[model samples]
Target: MKTILVIGTYDTKDDELHYICQRIADMGGQVLSMDVSVLGDPSAPTDLSKHQVAEAGGASIRQAIDAGDENAAMQIMARGAAALTAQLYADGKIDGMLALGGTMGTDLALDCAQALPLGVPKYVVSTVSFSPLIPADRLAPDIQMILWAGGLYGLNSVCKSSLSQAAGAVLGAAMAVEAPVSTRPVIGMTSLGSSCLKYMKHLRDPLQERGFEVAVFHATGMGGMAFESLAQQGYFAAVMDFALPELGNLMVGSVVHSGPERLTRAGAAGTPQIVAPGCADLVDYAGWQDIPAAYTDRPFHAHNRLIKSAALSGDERRALVRDIVARLERANAPVHVLMPKGGVEEWDREGGEAHDPQALAAMADEMEKTVKAPLGLTMLDAHINDAAFADAALAVLDGWIADGTVKLG
Candidate 1:
């Protein structure tokens, strides 16, 4: 039977917390409770007591009580709870985790959830499920957050429905979840969809045939976040970072962008990387929102109902070259950069809607000026979608594999 670790401030929400534990038990799933309460006692004992949690965080429960500020004391408890939760998962004592909370509980729950690795099932039943108060970086890439409606006061029927569903979801996830495969060396690649970026089509097969697993991530906001997280963990043997508008989006303050650590992680982890500016010419904006005044006069491409793009100016494209090159320069591993001289994205070709030859020329000129040795730079006389660009990227990968830069299985 799967075991779900239940976490909460058992002092006030004991009734609701116990109800979830009961549902899990009824479903033939075991429950291990951890109470993170600061003052009052839980209705019954917890598998991990408040005292244990406080002590694990490098303080005693008496010290937490003596500190006497709610937020400050809770921060201490959050630290302890996260440490213990990580230890529980590491010790193989918990299969999945479920937490119930309002703002304070949700804050601690996020810390606990992040303590576990990427694949672990982490569900948070909270008052603020998807609130803007919760930053994107605090969340585990795989966390499931459900609104804990009618769950604050007591165990009502509406609250019971949410609790039961969460219990079932966590248990089911634990039983059915498949860990990431590791039969061959994994290649982490980034790309936009085939329409905008076409190099992945030619590259995926040849890399796989070389006994490498090519895992391509879409370079949208959350997709890039996941890619960066995996790369930080040193999850890939090598990375082919082709499509790169997410970096540009982040630089331009677009919500459709990923977090700050996108391009730097693979190299920091010492993984060999063949980087390219596949979609660096455009900045993605949320299509549903009003177009920002700054980009109103620029060329636009409505990729879909959810996302749109605005072409950067010639000067902006030149600035992007410096940013991309600077990021590559900081990588701690083997790094080679590919610059497609003709154009980066599909819409930037001669007759395409967002085409601007001068902007492309400015970008190429800046790359030529800044990209230097120790970090390899290859300038190709082809569009990013052309066979020459793909062939050049594969050749770099083949050369890396032939050498000891990329370790194979």
Candidate 2:
């Protein structure tokens, strides 16, 4: 029998959740309501009591609720709910999950829903659904439904229609989910077109050989954000950032800014990381036609007919170094920042049109000065594509692996 796991703070959202559960049961679907409230008792009866859910979450539910404020209690209850849901699914009990709430309830419910593996349809009906801040809709590879403008106990007609539609959608999705055959840890690689193939050749295969499935993301503004989001989603065990061209775009007011939290996710999540200066020296523009007047005199290299690259100037290089170091400094997990001194981009290499020794030196000096973390700094005197550069990166990773800086599992 397919059991639909309906989760909510029964104490706070009893009326709405009870309404949804009744509809699910009436639709001939098995409904299991899981109460996620740290404080008061649930208004609706549930398959799993608050104490049970808290136990499943590896915490004392009653204690957490009594000790914390409303916000803190919600966070605690969300963790418990997610842990309980994960256990239920692992035990082959939950077939699907549905959540109904405004922003706070939506946040807690989705936190639990995401615990289900990809393809297990998760739905959130929220009033804030129209102005969705949840990136799960856009980012997660999983199919997440966000039903907008879900009113509170509205006119019977409107409420019935919306609830019926949402319930049916969630039920259908749960029935269709394919069972996961494996739970391979995803490795996210941030690359540019110029260096993507190289990642496959040098890093991806090596990582797979060491038992990891690789997912490569472009270093464009959107691509970097998506890759980091996946890391925060706990979808990736490690991050290999090979193309960092977005730094130059961010500094130059280009359309390619990767936002403020570009390289900071893995560190915050304690995901093992390998950072690089790959494509760090240049910024790509639409074409030579869009090059700023001040940069018109600088050397330019045509990557293709449509894209042109220009190496950073001395001051820009220094700023890039500081930004890069700041990110590296914040990492709590095993981190290694490798600098390919021969050049950070193809054009900056010897005999390339965008080569600028002055800019390169300034960048390196800033790194030496700014990156004072013991053993965090790895300056390799080789071209990025050189076998030596690859060897150095692998060596740093291997050292971290041996030293237990990164969890071997």
Candidate 3:
């Protein structure tokens, strides 16, 4: 039977949490109810009591309550909640976790859920589920079941039925799933259609040969964000960031810029990272006609009938180097910036329409000046797609991961 862990301030919402627990039991799942109440007695018989929670948190229940501050109380409760869930997990008593809450209850339950590994089903039924959540308790990483419960104190029959079904849903999902395959550490890579196909094809075979999986992202705005978000989520062991055309798009006011959080995750999450200036030679624009008339005088490349590229100017190159350097500094993981001297893109090589020796040199000089200490910079004589370049990129990542060069933040 699947084990269901239900957490709440049983001193207050005991009836609702217990009702959900009962439905889980009715579905043939074992229930382990935990009470995180600060004051008052628990409304139902619980597997873990608030007093026990306090003790587990290294404080006495009355002592914690006497502190009387909400934030401190929440911290005590979160500590207790994590300890309780961890004990249950160690004793093989938790298969899935669900929490019912408003604000305080959600805060306590989320602490426990966040402590668990990714992919475990953690559901929250809350009043504040629809409310704008502050950054302190953001639930972006964990999956949340938003039940538009507009300020109701007690569950109506409708609430009971919906919550019961939710219990069954989480329970069934927990028990009936086949475990995911234990694949080698996979790296998520970002690239654009113009360069991604050849770039990934060149990188994947060798990386896979070395027992690493390479997941590629098409550098659409969403694709790049999703790639980095997964890194922040701890889904990838390393990142082979090749395409930063999204930066150009942002600078030139195009539609393909990934959000401001792009390169920050690798630093924050401490994932091993290697970034390249691939496809940074130009900003991508839609249709030939859509190319701004102002850009008509600049060097341009027609990658296809639909796509046109504009070579970044000297001033733009300086700004981009600053942007890239700032991103590298924010990276908590060991970072290496690989500059392809021969070319930054497929069309940036000698005889290529967008090739500009002066522009490339300025970019390199800016990066050399901007990146200092522990963070390293590599200048490559070959293009980004070259076998030598890919090999060097992989070597930097492998070396850092093997040597513990990147400190986990």
Candidate 4:
């Protein structure tokens, strides 16, 4: 039977926790309840009490209860829960995990969820699943969350339905997930839909033929974050970072900023990386989101109901190029910057709405002037999506692989 860890501040969420525990049991799963409450006694029976959890975080239970500071107490419990959760997973006692909470509970649960490695099932039922209050950098790359609607304080019909779904989801994941088998070294690539699909198509087969697995990440804000996180974790043998719209988003103070350290991780990890200024010409926002006042007059394109993009001005493009140069300067590994002179995106070609050769030229000029070794800079006559650009990028990566600068499995 799958052992799913149930986490919560049982002092306040006892009934909800008990209901989910029973639901998981009904589904033929075992429960390992961990109580994280700091103040009052737990209403439900717990296998691991708050006292143990508090001590795990380096504090005594009595000290936590007497502190009378909710924030401080929650932070303490969160640290303890994270350490205990990792230990449980390491011991093969936790197959999956589910937690329910408002703010404090969600905070502690997120800590525990992040402590578990990727591919382990992690779910959080929270009233504030994707709220702005939760810092994006603190979230695990693959955490799944259900917005707990009308499921606070006690077990109502709505609460039961949500809880049952959480139980089923976690249990099903635990039963179905198989251990990952070792494979050829993975080459991490980033791109966007339609805008840079041609480059990805050209690179994938060639990289595979050269004995490396290609893993592509879409360059939405979160996609960039995940790619950076995985790179920092040493998950990729090399990286072909083609899409950079997230940087443009960050440049203009858009809501879609990938964390502050987006482009620097692969270099910090000493992973060979071939960087391209693909899709750096635009910033993306939700289709329903209003254009920021500063960018109101910029050229705009609505790709679909879910995505809208705006072209960057010459000044904005220069700022982005400088940012790229600054990041490349810090590389501890082999880095190459490929400049596509024709255009950077599908809409950036001649006769297109985003066409601006002068702006593209400015970016290339800035890179030439500012970027230095251990960064190599190359300017190509082809568009970013063209076969020529893909061939150039692959050749650079192939050279590194052949010279033992990048080792393949």
Report clashes for each candidate as comma-separated counts.
0, 0, 2, 0
Best candidate according to TM-score: 4
Clash pairs (backbone) in predicted model 1: none
Model 1 vs. true fold: TM:
0.93
The lDDT values for all models are 0.89, 0.72, 0.75, 0.86
Question: Tens-digit lDDT track for model 2 on 131-212?
Answer: 4265422333343555544366443566656667777777877777685443566677877775422544677677677766
| lDDT rank order | 1, 4, 3, 2
User: Across residues 1-409, which tens digit of lDDT does each residue of candidate 1 receive?
Assistant: 8899999999999999998999899989999999999999998899999999999888988898888788888898999999999999999999889999999999999999988887799999998997767765677778998898888788899988888899889988989988776899999999989999998888888888889998888888777877887888899999989888988888888887677777988989988889888889899887778888998888889998989999998899888889888888888988888999999999999889889888889988898898898888998999989989989988998898788788777
Deviating ranges (above 4 Å) for candidate 3: 130-142, 148-151, 178-183, 188-206, 215-237, 241-271, 277-334, 339-365, 372-374, 379-409
Model 1: worst 10 consecutive residues (lDDT sum)? 132-141
Task: Give candidate 2's whole-model lDDT.
Answer: 0.72
Candidate order by TM-score, decreasing, is 4, 1, 3, 2
Which stretches in model 2 have alpha-carbon errors above 4 Å? 1-182, 194-197, 286-289, 304-307
Worst 10 residues of 4 by lDDT: 132-141
Pairs that clash in candidate 4: none
Q: TM per model?
A: 0.93, 0.59, 0.65, 0.95
Question: How well is each residue in 311-368 modelled by candidate 4, as lDDT tens digits?
Answer: 8887788889889878877878899999988888889888887788888888777767
